[model samples]
Target: MKPDYELLVRGNNLRLKDDFLGMSNVTLIQGPSGPILFDTGGYISRLGLLKALDARGLKPADIPLVFLSHLHFDHAHNVDLFAHAEFLVSRREWDYVGAPHPDDLLVPWGIREQLSKSRVTLIEGEGQIDRGIGFFPAPGHTPGCFAIELDTERGTTVIAGDAIKYAKEAILRRCDMAFDEIEVGTATIRNILDRADRIMPGHFPELVRLPDGNFVWDEAAPFELMVR
Candidate 1:
């Protein structure tokens, strides 16, 4: 089965807000087994996100699995929207949420009940959630920050989450730019770059590798994810 997918680039050009510091992206993966919703976009874009999904002939109820990159409000606000989908979160991530630090202000509190009230799987480290979907710890933006990987038609593509917020930052190997852990962030970026053919970052433009082992931003690329 090929990993077929589309990105609702809400964090990028979807909204026009000069003051918005960063953008959030939500992905819809039409897996062989079922539909997978990756990240729920932002709270402010709830209605827009729903419309976007409707435009694609999909609904939150139709999604069977909801995988979150992290629990940041911008990327996780709409999680509760998928009333029946099973939510997958990092075990370590919830630990921080259970006891948030001052710096970890992005902790999602509104959907606290939804997070655990439904069927939730606490992913610890790297493991396969489905046939072609996998995840591993890549903390930086948050304590239990993680990223999701997919076996797509393009190759091994990874949704790098906030681990490498921007493709430019990945090229620089800069971890100091993250919100939480710094050193681990840089290492995680390197780790993803070394393996993934393409990376859909959390904030910046998606990055595809060139023949020269360099990455360039692709603003027009449509991620047709297919999982085999």
Candidate 2:
């Protein structure tokens, strides 16, 4: 059976002067074993994340597995919330984080110390996590960045965390932000566009593949903000 899924937190690419929004999308997939969460949001979305979970009638402990696409602060910092869940991270990611370049500011400091307290499992290469859910390498933004593939009623959806952060990237078939070689990131984007019927990007609304072989954003609820 195809497991159910939901977008717990819709990611955004908004940034302000001297301030980065750095909000990545968080997805919840109901696996055969139990609830599996893909990429927990950063500290900025802490309360919003909790409220999102509560709205779904779930607690952090209720999640059995947490998958990190990479070790970016916007995507991986909130892993601490799920104390009881087993975290699935890329083995390559773990190694890279251990000796990240000083200029990579998106990688939070003290990651090893933070995750040492949790039960973490390292993943390598492509593999299936469940019957309809699997993972494949899509590194670019980070050396170990991986994207999750889900077989849903809508067809194959790729949860491309930062690998294909925006629809424009997929549409352009290139990555705008790449810590690695730009060609490597572009290749990853092309690979994703070639295989995925739809894409749940890291920091943008979902993208649907058109019959004409073009990718366009799906209709999503409007983002709201309150001003005093």
Candidate 3:
């Protein structure tokens, strides 16, 4: 049976509601070949994605491949759920995840060990994963943060994980607390806005379009002016 692609918007994390303007978004893309999951939510809500997939008559095993935007716990904590799937991530991001870091313990040792055993594919630059799907490196949010581009009948949709958190942040070049560097994140967001017509940010809504012929970020009508 041909698989159906869908983006499942899970629960919103309001822990930092007072400080950061960010939420967790989990994407479910069911292609003709198989299903692909993007950025699993935190460990606590890991099964939440599985439940969502179950509702669609799919399971973690049905997902042949999984792409992670980065190694941050919030974005990749539930990766272990798909042990049978080949996990893809940016080469730089993989190294960062494997690297020993005593300062930050957000990523647990068990998760890293599990990842080491899984089928991990490290990608460099832009490359076509399938007929209409492609992966591109969009560092800045993290050293190896990347985005997934899908060509559809509607238009080209870029699933920009953390490279561009919110539509408003992308338009205004606004960096959140999770970004490693502001300048790099800003440049990456600019690169995405320059290429993609519609952007599916990791957080805040599904897709936002770049106003006709506008390459620069617009602060006035940031998130409110999205294409939906």
- Give me the candidate number with maximum lDDT: 2
Once fitted onto the true fold, the runs of candidate 2 whose alpha carbons sit more than 4 angstroms away are none
Displacement of residue 31 (Cα, Å) in model 2 is 1.8
* Position 135, candidate 2: lDDT: 95
Best model per TM-score: 2
lDDT of 2 by residue, 122-207 (tens): 99999999989999989888888999999888888999999998777987898888876678899999999988888999989889
Query: How much is the lDDT of residue 178 in candidate 1?
Result: 58
Model 3: residues >4 Å from true position, as ranges? 1-4, 11-13, 17-23, 100-105, 210-228
Q: Which ten contiguous residues of candidate 3 have the minimum total lDDT?
A: 216-225
Worst 10 residues of 2 by lDDT: 217-226
Please, what are the lDDT tens digits per residue for candidate 1 over residues 1-228? 887677765455333374454557777877878888888877766887888888988777888898888787888887778767788889887777777668666767755676776788888978987788888988876777888889999898988777877666678877655566678787888898888889888776778899988889857633332599
Between prediction 2 and prediction 3, the one with superior TM-score is 2
Q: What is the alpha-carbon lDDT of model 1 when measured against the actual structure? A: 0.77
Ranking by lDDT: 2, 1, 3
